[model samples]
Target: MRIAVAAPTGHVGRHLVPMLIRAGVKPLLLLRDPDRLAPDVRPEVDVAEVDLLDADAVVRAVSGVDALYWVDPPPAGHNPLAEYKLATASAARAVTEGGVGRVVFQSSVGAERRHGMGEIDGLAATEVALNATDANVVHLRCGYFFTNLEYQVDAIRAGALQVLLPVNQPMAWVSPRDIAEVAAGRLLSEEWRGRIVQAVHGPADLSWQQVVGIISEAVGKPLEVERIPEEEMRGTLAGFGMSAEQIDSLVGMSTGFLGGFTPEQERSVHSTTPTTLAEWAYTELKPMLQ
Candidate 1:
């Protein structure tokens, strides 16, 4: 199968590409900056330096590809929602015009609601467009990234974790590596058909308090969970140099996940992944704490 990966340098893409290679598939990488890809892996894959906003360019780049691994990359400009619409539209065009066979789209858990989730609304667009296509599409409705905890690294070390989410609500905090693993397994095989919603729920459902305990243990320090108010969180994001638009999106994301945010796809043996926070913290986060 002729496979293609967009944003091969991204958190999940980086992991996904190596898995594809190890599985003996040479993937065509569609990216804006070829140099962003690791120097060592560049030689093994086909590179197309095409901006995702350009439909013609993306269609051209992906033409004749059998499968595609597409995720709405982080907005390179200030208009994130606009970028998501255009990028997903371009990839969808590639599916139809370029005759791509399968699409493994990286979407978020709250995408089922499809709106009011700020940037996640953009991901929902990808799901909609792919679903319209004839190509086999699997929308990996992923959970809140474990990497998001990196934002609280300093706070965790200071013995207090100011969380934005409701402390009592259990959320699926997953590793990108695990998401990539599931995506690779799906892309490499052709067992299922139609639009499949697979939730990448890591190990177990965990509350913010439970998360803090696991993280605290890994960092070898006791930490407190301070659930900051939305406005305060706004100021914090602004302090970090996030623009107003980005802040609004994040704030909306918080509210969107509040109540009625349960994933449409119920957790089952297939939906749950194996990696736990303790395991990920020890390996990925513990080292970062140093």
Candidate 2:
């Protein structure tokens, strides 16, 4: 089977591509810069060097592919919603024009909510657009990525874990590996027809405090969990050179979480993956921190 993977070197795509190759399926990678792909994996899959924003180019990239794994890349500057809409629209057009048989979209947990969701609202919009298309579509509504902790490695090493939300509040988290695994399975099977929504949650819902404790044990050191106020989070993001829109979008996501906005329904047990906080801390987090 021939599959087209957008953002082939991205968080999930990096793992999904290798899994597809191992399954005896060929992947046509849509990469803006093919050089970003690992040298070793380049020989395994077909590469299409094309810009996703260009509708015509995207159509050509997915042409004749049996399935497309579409993941929206992080927004470049400010105005992530606009960026998402533009990219998703182009991709939708491509899926229709290219006659791709199936599509697996990477979305977020709070995407069902319309307001106060920040950037996740963009995923909701993307879902709407993709669902309107004639081809079979599967919306993979994923939870908070455990890999997001990689950004806190420096802070953890300094004995502090900074976050905008309350440490004691429970939140759902998922491993990128699990998301890739589910997407790969759907793409490889290509069986589900029409529209389907799958919630890819982690093994368990955990509080930030519990997660920090696991991190401390993994690194063999005590780490403090510091909660940054929403207003101050804006300043910190600004210091990091994020544009106003980018800062608002990110902070808005945290605000939504603090407000208790989350998935409306319970995720099925079948959708949950086996990776746990302790396991992720020992494997992915520890290696990055050390």
Question: Which candidate number has the best lDDT?
Answer: 1
Error of 1 at 226 (Å): 1.1
lDDT string, candidate 1, 54-165, tens digits: 9999999999988888877778666688888898889799999999888899998999998999889889988998999999999998888888887778887788877678
Regions more than 4 Å wrong, model 1: none
User: 199-225, model 2: which lDDT tens digit per residue?
Assistant: 988888888898888889988999888
TM-score of 1: 0.95
Each model's TM-score? 0.95, 0.95
Q: Candidate 1: worst 10 consecutive residues by lDDT? A: 71-80
User: What is the number of backbone collisions in each predicted candidate, taken in the order shown?
Assistant: 0, 0
Model 1 alpha-carbon miss at residue 285, Å: 1.2
Give the winner by TM-score: 2
The CA lDDT of each predicted structure is 0.87, 0.85
The count of residue-pair clashes in candidate 1 stands at 0
Q: For every candidate structure, what is the RMSD over all alpha carbons to the true structure, in angstroms?
A: 1.6, 1.4
Instruction: Report the Cα lDDT for residue 178, model 2.
Output: 90
